[model samples]
Target: MGAVLQLLSMAGSVLGFVFLTLCIASGLYYISEIVEEHTEPTRRFLTRTIWVIEILLLLLLIFDKFPIKLTIFAMGSHMLYYQNLKKFPYISLTSITFLSSCIVVVMNHYLWFKHFNEVDIPPQFHYDPNYVPPRRATFSQVSSFFAICIWFMPFALFVSLSAGDYVLPTTVEQAKKTDEITELNSETTAKLRGRTIGLARVVIHNVRKYIYSVLALFGIQVQRDYDNLGI
Candidate 1:
């Protein structure tokens, strides 16, 4: 019986992996359309394809074999945070929001593995008509990789602010001396203002991180409750 269950679990995992592949592929196509300035229809089609695949994959988690309902809920929460990035679009907010999405995806995968370990599964089954396995899974890690890429924004902001503090003259004396040499010294004041802006950006970035961290913490708590209750 355990052997049969293991086989079934493996089958579900394979299907889940395929769903991930389709999502990534369709996402790439959507991004490509954006990059190439393609027509609205092409971009919309790609987005719709990804959404369909995502919903079907969530169904598999719920009803296919392992009862991954909690994982699906966590995924939906990620989508909320991702939408927050769209609404804000600031570099720091976008970076943190995107990283939050990545963390949520990782947690979902962890839940998938946990479900396989715990649930009783059927021996064998075939995918539905719309489900298609990828020829290679090399691109499967792209989502996580993109999450890593978002980290660069925060890092850059931090470094830029740190360097600006060292190099940008911020003293009242410095400003006064420059004023005596030239009226208002617009160039010097502009450079100082730019540095101040960089410092402000760093603060904003950290604040966004805190907001997303709170969301992620809430998600983890909900996930734990769902797992404990077997919901």
Candidate 2:
């Protein structure tokens, strides 16, 4: 009975992990779509907020209120993220900015993990047996610090950053061109209804290809079809 229960528990754990991974992938994909759709506004908001945080971290460091090393690291990470702004909406996975962004993510995760661990486990001072340790951080204080100082900007940048390979036309002229092409090939009158139906079929096929490309990001296997929709 105990073995059977253990097997069930292990199965449940595996299923839970799969579900969580799917949720994260879907959420990231949705965020990337939104960022691609609103590139300019998203860029401005992220850039401004990052700079603000960098300034605040500098001030805290100046006052000797924050760990100087961690503060400087955080500020540097923000600067790296700022560099990507120059190539906004066209991030190369192999570019310096993207690589730096990846590094900073790991750095932030390590720094905060260490910080929280330190807070939770006070070091023993062998020299002073009776020396009292400082008070541990409250849950709210820890959460606030993690949200604002440790994870906020990094996570936001990760979600906002899109691969250059997936770049899509977002300009007014490009959109107009797409519309014109679609209209030129699609017939509005019943006399040309057969052509319209064919165009609709092609559009549906292209949409399926787009969805398959998105799924490929999650390591899903898909057969590619290069048939272009008239547009």
Candidate 3:
């Protein structure tokens, strides 16, 4: 088990380095895209957020006490929030970056849980042993793992965007303003009955087709898979 753990740690370290490089390369691309360095506040915020996340991941890989549960939750939260935020101010590059981060974060969690199944990784941090799923977590492990994977990163990103941490100034007042703006927009939409109906139908059609395409490509039943995963 010790030797297996060592190998896993080494593999994780290598993967971490690769991820870091990818982050740096991507960051440069983002920075170069900025017309006015000071004007694009969200770019700065996102750069910092990505670096912080990368550092956190690296530290976890290095020390083996990276707070897997908390990190998982944070990553998921960020992903969820960012997805919703695309509706507000749609920047294609930033949106792409957010989506990419989401994919990477989810993949990391999935890989971690998948690897945990093959080898007993020493607990990186102290958690209630009772909180531990089981010696061989198997299906319960993957299910819980993905549950966090699905929701936490996106939600965290959402919080960041709402607070403006991913954009500019993430403060309470800013959040209130955002809320007001969003509410005002919603109210305006409410008044456009005919347009709203048209918009709703268009959204429904696009969403339905998109979902059907995904389903057809990946098989239609998700619930059964969750059950099979022991959810």
Candidate 4:
């Protein structure tokens, strides 16, 4: 009986996680739609936010005794992210700028994860256990810095940027290819769009479809119509 209860509890946790993931995915999809509607304004805001974060990083580097190499690299990563803004919300996945941005996102996460786990990553001054820095980062300070300066823009981009694959039809052949719109690799659409689509939208669409399929098999009905990934 205890073993059975344990198994049931695990199953419940798994189910809860899956449900929560789907909900978040749906929210991201909705946010992406709103971002599509406000592309220009959103682009400007992201640009300014990048500038602000870069300034904050400089402040930390000079004042907080943050590791110099890591701070510089972080700033450089932000620059790469900024490059994606030229085309604004539409991104070419094959582009070097987009690929570099993705790399830095992972690198930043990995660096911060290690930084937070270890002490004395700073200069020699940090080894003096008795002497605390004048402007040491407290829990809230670091948390906010991590959330806003480090992670915020990347997360925002994930929810805002669309792949360039779904292009506005230009040619007569493309115009007749309504069926190609749904495909990721339709030659006409891919040629015109250059392979851009909302990365997050695609994920949300597929996730919702999978969840709906699973629920349907169990006689559960999902009311949310995510047929076009919230369009």
Best by TM-score: 4
Residue 182, candidate 3: Cα error in Å is 19
User: What TM-score, computed on C-alpha atoms, does each candidate reach?
Assistant: 0.30, 0.62, 0.28, 0.71
Off by over 4 Å in 1: 1-36, 39-47, 74-78, 81-95, 117-231
Q: Ranking under lDDT, best-scoring first?
A: 4, 2, 3, 1
Stronger candidate by lDDT (1 vs 2) = 2
Best-fitting candidate, scored by lDDT? 4
Ranking by TM-score: 4, 2, 1, 3
> Better model by TM-score, 2 or 3?
2
Candidate 4 per-residue lDDT, tens place, 74-108, comes to 89998988888888777877888888898899999
The positional error of residue 143 in candidate 3, measured at the CA in angstroms, is 1.1
- How far residue 170's Cα lies from its native spot in candidate 2, in Å, is 14
Question: For residues 1-231, what per-residue lDDT tens digits would candidate 3 score against the true structure?
Answer: 699999999999999998996676455334333312232365346545545654655565466553476566555555444454454223233556666765666666666665565654457635646555445545874576455544444433432332111222333355466675344565553343121111122233355556667887887744322111110
Please estimate how well model 4 matches the true structure, expressed as its whole-model Cα lDDT. Answer: 0.78
- Candidate 1 per-residue lDDT, tens place, 73-163, comes to 5447445343432322223434565556556656655664454345333334254555544333234443442333223223322222221
**Stretches of candidate 4 above 4 Å error?**
1-16, 120-139, 165-197, 211-224
lDDT of candidates 1 onward, in order: 0.44, 0.66, 0.47, 0.78
Flag regions of model 2 displaced more than 4 Å. 55-64, 119-125, 138-140, 165-231
> What TM-score does prediction 3 earn?
0.28
RMSD of 3: 19.6
